[model samples]
Target: MTERRQSVQQSPADWVARQAELYEESGGTEGTTMRGAPCLLMDYRGRRTGDWRRTVLIFGRDGEDYLVVASNGGADNHPLWYLNLESDPRVRLRVLTERFDARAETLGHEEKQRVWPHLVEVFPPYADYQRGTSRDIPVVRLRRV
Candidate 1:
Protein backbone atom coordinates (compact mmCIF):
# COMPACT_ATOMS: atom_id res chain seq x y z
CA MET A 1 0.00 0.00 0.00
CA THR A 2 1.21 3.51 -0.77
CA GLU A 3 1.60 5.93 2.08
CA ARG A 4 -0.56 9.02 1.59
CA ARG A 5 0.45 12.45 2.87
CA GLN A 6 -2.19 14.80 4.13
CA SER A 7 -1.94 18.50 3.32
CA VAL A 8 -1.38 20.54 6.47
CA GLN A 9 -3.96 23.04 7.62
CA GLN A 10 -2.29 26.33 8.40
CA SER A 11 -3.25 28.61 11.22
CA PRO A 12 -6.27 30.83 10.65
CA ALA A 13 -4.35 33.79 11.99
CA ASP A 14 -2.95 35.71 9.05
CA TRP A 15 0.45 36.45 10.55
CA VAL A 16 0.96 32.90 11.65
CA ALA A 17 -0.05 31.53 8.27
CA ARG A 18 2.28 33.91 6.50
CA GLN A 19 5.17 33.10 8.80
CA ALA A 20 4.75 29.39 8.29
CA GLU A 21 4.65 29.96 4.56
CA LEU A 22 7.91 31.91 4.55
CA TYR A 23 9.61 29.43 6.83
CA GLU A 24 8.71 26.42 4.73
CA GLU A 25 9.25 28.09 1.39
CA SER A 26 12.77 29.11 2.29
CA GLY A 27 13.57 25.67 3.58
CA GLY A 28 13.71 26.93 7.17
CA THR A 29 16.05 29.77 6.26
CA GLU A 30 13.57 32.62 6.31
CA GLY A 31 10.90 33.27 8.93
CA THR A 32 13.10 31.48 11.45
CA THR A 33 12.74 34.29 13.95
CA MET A 34 9.68 35.86 15.54
CA ARG A 35 10.33 39.29 17.05
CA GLY A 36 13.97 38.36 17.73
CA ALA A 37 13.09 34.93 19.12
CA PRO A 38 13.96 31.74 17.30
CA CYS A 39 11.02 29.75 15.96
CA LEU A 40 10.26 26.29 14.66
CA LEU A 41 7.51 24.85 12.51
CA MET A 42 5.62 22.12 14.34
CA ASP A 43 3.27 19.70 12.60
CA TYR A 44 0.70 17.73 14.56
CA ARG A 45 -2.41 15.68 13.90
CA GLY A 46 -5.73 17.27 14.72
CA ARG A 47 -7.67 15.60 17.48
CA ARG A 48 -11.07 15.71 15.79
CA THR A 49 -10.30 16.08 12.10
CA GLY A 50 -7.27 13.77 12.07
CA ASP A 51 -5.72 16.04 9.50
CA TRP A 52 -2.24 17.49 9.67
CA ARG A 53 -1.90 20.95 11.23
CA ARG A 54 1.05 23.29 11.22
CA THR A 55 2.00 26.26 13.37
CA VAL A 56 4.93 28.44 14.21
CA LEU A 57 6.08 28.48 17.81
CA ILE A 58 8.87 30.20 19.64
CA PHE A 59 11.31 27.63 20.95
CA GLY A 60 13.86 27.61 23.71
CA ARG A 61 16.66 25.22 24.42
CA ASP A 62 16.68 22.93 27.42
CA GLY A 63 19.98 21.21 26.81
CA GLU A 64 19.17 19.12 23.71
CA ASP A 65 15.40 19.26 24.06
CA TYR A 66 13.23 21.97 22.51
CA LEU A 67 10.73 23.81 24.67
CA VAL A 68 7.52 25.57 23.61
CA VAL A 69 4.98 27.51 25.61
CA ALA A 70 1.20 27.16 25.55
CA SER A 71 0.61 30.69 26.70
CA ASN A 72 -1.85 31.46 23.91
CA GLY A 73 -1.03 35.13 24.46
CA GLY A 74 -2.27 34.79 28.04
CA ALA A 75 -5.74 33.66 27.04
CA ASP A 76 -7.79 31.58 29.43
CA ASN A 77 -7.93 28.66 27.02
CA HIS A 78 -4.94 26.77 25.73
CA PRO A 79 -3.94 26.99 22.09
CA LEU A 80 -5.58 24.52 19.75
CA TRP A 81 -2.23 23.08 18.82
CA TYR A 82 -1.49 22.41 22.47
CA LEU A 83 -4.79 20.67 22.91
CA ASN A 84 -4.20 18.56 19.82
CA LEU A 85 -0.80 17.48 21.07
CA GLU A 86 -2.32 16.59 24.43
CA SER A 87 -4.45 14.02 22.65
CA ASP A 88 -1.63 12.89 20.35
CA PRO A 89 1.92 13.63 21.37
CA ARG A 90 3.48 12.58 18.13
CA VAL A 91 4.77 15.55 16.11
CA ARG A 92 7.15 16.65 13.42
CA LEU A 93 9.40 19.65 14.11
CA ARG A 94 11.32 21.69 11.61
CA VAL A 95 14.12 23.60 13.25
CA LEU A 96 15.99 25.72 10.81
CA THR A 97 17.03 23.29 8.10
CA GLU A 98 16.55 20.12 10.12
CA ARG A 99 13.31 18.20 10.44
CA PHE A 100 12.63 15.30 12.77
CA ASP A 101 9.94 13.39 14.54
CA ALA A 102 9.36 14.27 18.19
CA ARG A 103 7.07 13.57 21.10
CA ALA A 104 5.51 16.37 23.10
CA GLU A 105 5.75 16.13 26.86
CA THR A 106 3.91 18.64 29.04
CA LEU A 107 6.04 19.42 32.04
CA GLY A 108 4.58 18.96 35.46
CA HIS A 109 4.62 21.64 38.13
CA GLU A 110 7.99 20.78 39.64
CA GLU A 111 9.65 20.29 36.29
CA LYS A 112 8.23 23.53 34.91
CA GLN A 113 9.39 25.43 37.95
CA ARG A 114 12.90 24.11 37.39
CA VAL A 115 13.06 25.40 33.83
CA TRP A 116 10.66 28.34 34.00
CA PRO A 117 13.41 30.83 34.51
CA HIS A 118 15.34 29.60 31.50
CA LEU A 119 12.21 29.77 29.38
CA VAL A 120 11.53 33.32 30.50
CA GLU A 121 15.07 34.27 29.59
CA VAL A 122 14.49 32.83 26.13
CA PHE A 123 11.44 35.04 25.60
CA PRO A 124 11.02 37.63 28.31
CA PRO A 125 7.41 38.33 27.40
CA TYR A 126 6.49 34.91 28.72
CA ALA A 127 6.64 36.29 32.25
CA ASP A 128 4.08 38.90 31.35
CA TYR A 129 1.91 36.31 29.66
CA GLN A 130 1.86 34.20 32.80
CA ARG A 131 0.90 37.10 34.99
CA GLY A 132 -1.86 38.24 32.70
CA THR A 133 -3.87 35.05 33.06
CA SER A 134 -5.24 32.98 35.91
CA ARG A 135 -4.41 29.74 34.14
CA ASP A 136 -1.07 28.12 34.75
CA ILE A 137 0.61 28.17 31.39
CA PRO A 138 1.95 24.86 30.26
CA VAL A 139 5.49 24.36 29.11
CA VAL A 140 5.96 21.51 26.70
CA ARG A 141 9.21 19.72 26.10
CA LEU A 142 9.76 18.25 22.65
CA ARG A 143 12.20 15.39 22.44
CA ARG A 144 13.29 13.49 19.40
CA VAL A 145 11.39 10.25 19.00
Candidate 2:
Protein backbone atom coordinates (compact mmCIF):
# COMPACT_ATOMS: atom_id res chain seq x y z
CA MET A 1 0.00 0.00 0.00
CA THR A 2 1.12 3.60 -0.60
CA GLU A 3 2.12 5.63 2.39
CA ARG A 4 -0.35 8.23 3.58
CA ARG A 5 0.97 11.75 3.17
CA GLN A 6 0.81 14.26 5.96
CA SER A 7 -1.44 17.31 5.78
CA VAL A 8 0.32 20.64 5.16
CA GLN A 9 -0.16 24.29 6.00
CA GLN A 10 0.64 27.47 4.12
CA SER A 11 3.60 29.56 5.16
CA PRO A 12 3.07 32.14 7.86
CA ALA A 13 4.26 34.86 5.54
CA ASP A 14 1.26 36.51 3.95
CA TRP A 15 2.82 37.01 0.54
CA VAL A 16 4.11 33.44 0.37
CA ALA A 17 0.75 32.05 1.35
CA ARG A 18 -1.00 34.19 -1.26
CA GLN A 19 1.46 33.23 -3.96
CA ALA A 20 1.09 29.51 -3.26
CA GLU A 21 -2.68 29.85 -3.19
CA LEU A 22 -2.79 31.68 -6.50
CA TYR A 23 -0.38 29.28 -8.12
CA GLU A 24 -2.48 26.25 -7.20
CA GLU A 25 -5.83 27.99 -7.70
CA SER A 26 -4.92 28.84 -11.28
CA GLY A 27 -3.46 25.40 -11.89
CA GLY A 28 0.00 26.93 -12.24
CA THR A 29 -1.06 29.26 -15.07
CA GLU A 30 -0.75 32.22 -12.72
CA GLY A 31 1.94 32.93 -10.10
CA THR A 32 4.46 31.13 -12.24
CA THR A 33 6.90 34.01 -12.45
CA MET A 34 8.82 35.95 -9.86
CA ARG A 35 10.79 39.07 -10.74
CA GLY A 36 10.27 38.34 -14.45
CA ALA A 37 11.85 34.89 -14.13
CA PRO A 38 10.16 31.49 -13.97
CA CYS A 39 9.37 29.87 -10.62
CA LEU A 40 8.05 26.59 -9.22
CA LEU A 41 6.21 25.49 -6.11
CA MET A 42 7.79 23.02 -3.65
CA ASP A 43 5.72 21.13 -1.13
CA TYR A 44 7.63 19.56 1.76
CA ARG A 45 6.77 18.21 5.16
CA GLY A 46 7.52 20.30 8.23
CA ARG A 47 10.24 18.67 10.32
CA ARG A 48 8.72 19.77 13.60
CA THR A 49 5.03 19.35 13.01
CA GLY A 50 4.98 16.77 10.22
CA ASP A 51 2.55 19.09 8.44
CA TRP A 52 2.93 20.01 4.79
CA ARG A 53 4.68 23.29 3.92
CA ARG A 54 4.87 24.99 0.58
CA THR A 55 7.17 27.63 -0.90
CA VAL A 56 7.44 29.35 -4.26
CA LEU A 57 11.04 29.25 -5.48
CA ILE A 58 12.86 30.56 -8.52
CA PHE A 59 14.51 27.73 -10.39
CA GLY A 60 17.01 26.79 -13.08
CA ARG A 61 17.06 23.59 -15.08
CA ASP A 62 19.96 21.13 -15.09
CA GLY A 63 18.94 18.69 -17.77
CA GLU A 64 15.86 17.15 -16.13
CA ASP A 65 16.69 18.19 -12.56
CA TYR A 66 15.61 21.48 -10.95
CA LEU A 67 17.86 23.84 -8.99
CA VAL A 68 16.78 25.99 -6.08
CA VAL A 69 18.76 28.33 -3.85
CA ALA A 70 18.24 28.41 -0.12
CA SER A 71 19.63 31.88 0.36
CA ASN A 72 16.95 32.99 2.83
CA GLY A 73 17.64 36.48 1.48
CA GLY A 74 21.22 36.31 2.77
CA ALA A 75 20.20 35.53 6.31
CA ASP A 76 22.68 33.78 8.60
CA ASN A 77 20.46 30.72 8.98
CA HIS A 78 19.23 28.38 6.29
CA PRO A 79 15.59 28.62 5.21
CA LEU A 80 13.14 26.45 7.10
CA TRP A 81 12.25 24.58 3.94
CA TYR A 82 15.85 23.62 3.39
CA LEU A 83 16.21 22.45 6.95
CA ASN A 84 13.02 20.45 6.67
CA LEU A 85 14.25 18.74 3.54
CA GLU A 86 17.49 17.86 5.24
CA SER A 87 15.54 15.62 7.59
CA ASP A 88 13.30 14.22 4.82
CA PRO A 89 14.15 14.57 1.15
CA ARG A 90 10.87 13.42 -0.34
CA VAL A 91 8.95 16.35 -1.84
CA ARG A 92 6.24 17.40 -4.27
CA LEU A 93 7.04 19.80 -7.10
CA ARG A 94 4.94 21.83 -9.50
CA VAL A 95 6.49 23.28 -12.62
CA LEU A 96 3.90 25.46 -14.29
CA THR A 97 1.05 22.99 -14.87
CA GLU A 98 3.13 19.85 -14.37
CA ARG A 99 3.39 18.16 -10.99
CA PHE A 100 5.82 15.47 -9.92
CA ASP A 101 7.56 13.66 -7.08
CA ALA A 102 11.20 14.39 -6.42
CA ARG A 103 13.98 14.00 -3.88
CA ALA A 104 16.08 16.97 -2.78
CA GLU A 105 19.85 16.70 -2.61
CA THR A 106 22.17 19.37 -1.25
CA LEU A 107 25.02 19.99 -3.63
CA GLY A 108 28.56 19.67 -2.33
CA HIS A 109 31.37 22.21 -2.69
CA GLU A 110 32.64 20.97 -6.05
CA GLU A 111 29.13 20.67 -7.45
CA LYS A 112 28.26 24.11 -6.15
CA GLN A 113 31.31 25.53 -7.92
CA ARG A 114 30.09 24.14 -11.22
CA VAL A 115 26.42 25.12 -10.83
CA TRP A 116 26.77 28.51 -9.12
CA PRO A 117 27.26 30.47 -12.27
CA HIS A 118 24.29 28.87 -13.98
CA LEU A 119 22.09 29.65 -11.01
CA VAL A 120 23.27 33.24 -11.03
CA GLU A 121 22.36 33.46 -14.68
CA VAL A 122 18.80 32.40 -13.86
CA PHE A 123 18.47 34.84 -10.91
CA PRO A 124 21.20 37.48 -10.69
CA PRO A 125 20.25 38.57 -7.19
CA TYR A 126 21.57 35.23 -5.93
CA ALA A 127 25.07 36.65 -6.41
CA ASP A 128 24.29 39.63 -4.24
CA TYR A 129 22.63 37.44 -1.64
CA GLN A 130 25.71 35.25 -1.34
CA ARG A 131 28.02 38.25 -1.02
CA GLY A 132 25.89 39.70 1.75
CA THR A 133 26.18 36.69 4.05
CA SER A 134 29.04 34.76 5.63
CA ARG A 135 27.19 31.47 5.59
CA ASP A 136 27.48 29.34 2.50
CA ILE A 137 24.04 29.29 0.99
CA PRO A 138 22.90 25.88 -0.18
CA VAL A 139 22.02 24.97 -3.78
CA VAL A 140 19.63 22.03 -3.92
CA ARG A 141 19.05 19.70 -6.83
CA LEU A 142 15.63 18.14 -6.95
CA ARG A 143 15.96 14.88 -8.82
CA ARG A 144 12.97 12.90 -10.02
CA VAL A 145 12.30 9.75 -8.06
Candidate 3:
Protein backbone atom coordinates (compact mmCIF):
# COMPACT_ATOMS: atom_id res chain seq x y z
CA MET A 1 0.00 0.00 0.00
CA THR A 2 1.17 3.46 -0.78
CA GLU A 3 1.80 6.08 1.83
CA ARG A 4 -0.52 8.28 -0.21
CA ARG A 5 -3.12 7.21 -2.73
CA GLN A 6 -4.29 8.96 -5.86
CA SER A 7 -6.76 11.72 -5.26
CA VAL A 8 -10.25 10.29 -5.35
CA GLN A 9 -12.64 11.46 -8.08
CA GLN A 10 -15.23 12.50 -5.53
CA SER A 11 -12.88 14.27 -3.20
CA PRO A 12 -13.62 17.82 -2.24
CA ALA A 13 -12.44 20.34 -4.85
CA ASP A 14 -9.43 22.56 -4.37
CA TRP A 15 -10.01 22.25 -0.69
CA VAL A 16 -6.34 22.10 0.23
CA ALA A 17 -5.09 25.05 -1.73
CA ARG A 18 -8.13 27.13 -0.99
CA GLN A 19 -7.89 26.47 2.69
CA ALA A 20 -4.23 27.36 2.66
CA GLU A 21 -4.96 30.59 0.84
CA LEU A 22 -7.76 31.51 3.16
CA TYR A 23 -5.70 30.72 6.21
CA GLU A 24 -2.67 32.57 4.95
CA GLU A 25 -4.58 35.66 3.92
CA SER A 26 -6.38 35.77 7.18
CA GLY A 27 -3.03 35.73 8.96
CA GLY A 28 -4.38 32.56 10.44
CA THR A 29 -7.49 34.40 11.54
CA GLU A 30 -10.12 32.84 9.25
CA GLY A 31 -10.77 30.26 6.49
CA THR A 32 -11.50 27.57 9.08
CA THR A 33 -14.90 26.29 7.92
CA MET A 34 -15.38 23.11 5.95
CA ARG A 35 -18.96 22.40 4.88
CA GLY A 36 -20.10 24.68 7.70
CA ALA A 37 -18.15 22.77 10.34
CA PRO A 38 -14.86 23.94 11.81
CA CYS A 39 -11.84 22.40 10.12
CA LEU A 40 -8.11 22.77 9.80
CA LEU A 41 -5.92 22.13 6.79
CA MET A 42 -3.37 19.38 7.36
CA ASP A 43 -0.25 19.28 5.20
CA TYR A 44 2.00 16.29 4.82
CA ARG A 45 4.34 14.73 2.29
CA GLY A 46 3.59 11.43 0.61
CA ARG A 47 5.97 8.79 1.93
CA ARG A 48 6.23 7.15 -1.48
CA THR A 49 6.16 10.22 -3.71
CA GLY A 50 7.62 12.79 -1.30
CA ASP A 51 5.25 15.37 -2.74
CA TRP A 52 3.14 17.59 -0.54
CA ARG A 53 -0.58 17.01 -0.08
CA ARG A 54 -3.17 18.66 2.08
CA THR A 55 -6.60 17.83 3.40
CA VAL A 56 -9.21 19.68 5.36
CA LEU A 57 -10.27 17.81 8.51
CA ILE A 58 -12.61 18.39 11.39
CA PHE A 59 -10.54 19.34 14.39
CA GLY A 60 -10.73 19.96 18.11
CA ARG A 61 -8.18 21.50 20.36
CA ASP A 62 -6.69 19.68 23.35
CA GLY A 63 -4.69 21.99 25.49
CA GLU A 64 -1.87 22.92 23.10
CA ASP A 65 -2.59 20.11 20.63
CA TYR A 66 -5.15 19.33 17.95
CA LEU A 67 -7.27 16.26 17.25
CA VAL A 68 -8.44 14.83 13.92
CA VAL A 69 -10.41 11.73 13.12
CA ALA A 70 -10.26 9.50 10.08
CA SER A 71 -14.05 9.18 9.96
CA ASN A 72 -14.41 9.47 6.18
CA GLY A 73 -17.97 10.28 7.09
CA GLY A 74 -18.29 6.70 8.33
CA ALA A 75 -17.42 5.29 4.93
CA ASP A 76 -16.00 1.80 4.59
CA ASN A 77 -12.57 3.11 3.66
CA HIS A 78 -10.31 5.42 5.53
CA PRO A 79 -10.05 8.90 4.11
CA LEU A 80 -7.18 9.76 1.76
CA TRP A 81 -5.72 11.99 4.42
CA TYR A 82 -5.41 8.96 6.66
CA LEU A 83 -3.40 7.21 4.00
CA ASN A 84 -1.20 10.25 3.57
CA LEU A 85 -0.45 10.31 7.26
CA GLU A 86 0.25 6.62 7.18
CA SER A 87 2.75 7.33 4.48
CA ASP A 88 4.51 10.03 6.51
CA PRO A 89 3.59 10.57 10.10
CA ARG A 90 5.21 13.97 10.24
CA VAL A 91 2.87 16.77 9.25
CA ARG A 92 2.14 20.47 9.37
CA LEU A 93 -1.12 22.05 10.36
CA ARG A 94 -2.81 25.42 10.10
CA VAL A 95 -5.42 26.46 12.59
CA LEU A 96 -6.88 29.89 13.18
CA THR A 97 -3.81 32.12 13.12
CA GLU A 98 -1.22 29.50 13.95
CA ARG A 99 0.99 27.14 11.98
CA PHE A 100 2.73 24.28 13.70
CA ASP A 101 4.72 21.13 13.19
CA ALA A 102 2.90 18.04 14.33
CA ARG A 103 3.27 14.32 14.81
CA ALA A 104 0.28 12.06 14.07
CA GLU A 105 -0.46 8.85 15.88
CA THR A 106 -3.48 6.60 16.22
CA LEU A 107 -5.09 6.71 19.61
CA GLY A 108 -5.37 3.58 21.71
CA HIS A 109 -8.81 2.08 22.15
CA GLU A 110 -9.42 3.49 25.61
CA GLU A 111 -7.89 6.78 24.56
CA LYS A 112 -10.14 6.86 21.53
CA GLN A 113 -13.15 6.13 23.65
CA ARG A 114 -12.25 9.06 25.81
CA VAL A 115 -11.46 11.37 22.93
CA TRP A 116 -14.34 10.41 20.62
CA PRO A 117 -16.72 12.41 22.72
CA HIS A 118 -14.42 15.39 22.52
CA LEU A 119 -14.39 15.17 18.75
CA VAL A 120 -18.16 14.97 18.56
CA GLU A 121 -18.38 17.99 20.75
CA VAL A 122 -16.37 20.08 18.31
CA PHE A 123 -18.52 18.91 15.41
CA PRO A 124 -21.66 17.08 16.37
CA PRO A 125 -21.80 15.37 12.98
CA TYR A 126 -19.03 13.02 14.12
CA ALA A 127 -21.52 10.92 16.11
CA ASP A 128 -23.77 10.79 13.08
CA TYR A 129 -20.74 10.15 10.91
CA GLN A 130 -19.86 7.21 13.12
CA ARG A 131 -23.26 5.60 12.73
CA GLY A 132 -23.36 5.79 8.94
CA THR A 133 -20.54 3.36 8.25
CA SER A 134 -19.13 0.02 9.35
CA ARG A 135 -15.45 0.83 9.48
CA ASP A 136 -13.83 1.72 12.77
CA ILE A 137 -13.19 5.41 12.80
CA PRO A 138 -9.71 6.37 14.00
CA VAL A 139 -8.98 9.32 16.18
CA VAL A 140 -5.55 10.84 15.66
CA ARG A 141 -4.07 13.44 17.90
CA LEU A 142 -1.62 15.94 16.42
CA ARG A 143 0.86 17.02 18.98
CA ARG A 144 3.32 19.77 18.40
CA VAL A 145 6.68 18.46 17.43
Error of 2 at 46 (Å): 0.9
Per-candidate local distance difference test: 0.93, 0.91, 0.77
What total of clashing residue pairs does each candidate reach?
0, 1, 1
**Model 3: per-residue lDDT, tens digit, 3-35?**
454542222557666776776668777778876
lDDT of 2 at 145: 83
Tell me the TM-score of model 1: 0.96
lDDT of the structure predicted as candidate 2: 0.91
My TM-score estimates for the predictions, one after another, are: 0.96, 0.95, 0.82
Q: lDDT per residue, candidate 2, 22-116, as tens digits?
A: 99989999999889878999999888987888999999988899999999988999999999999999999989999888999999999998999
How well does candidate 3 match the true structure, expressed as C-alpha RMSD?
A: 5.1
Highest-lDDT candidate: 1
Poorest stretch of ten by lDDT in candidate 1: 1-10
Candidate 3, run of 10 with poorest lDDT: 1-10
Candidate with the larger TM-score of 2 and 3? 2
- Candidate 3 regions exceeding 4 Å error are 1-12
- For candidate 2, the per-residue lDDT at 108 reads 97
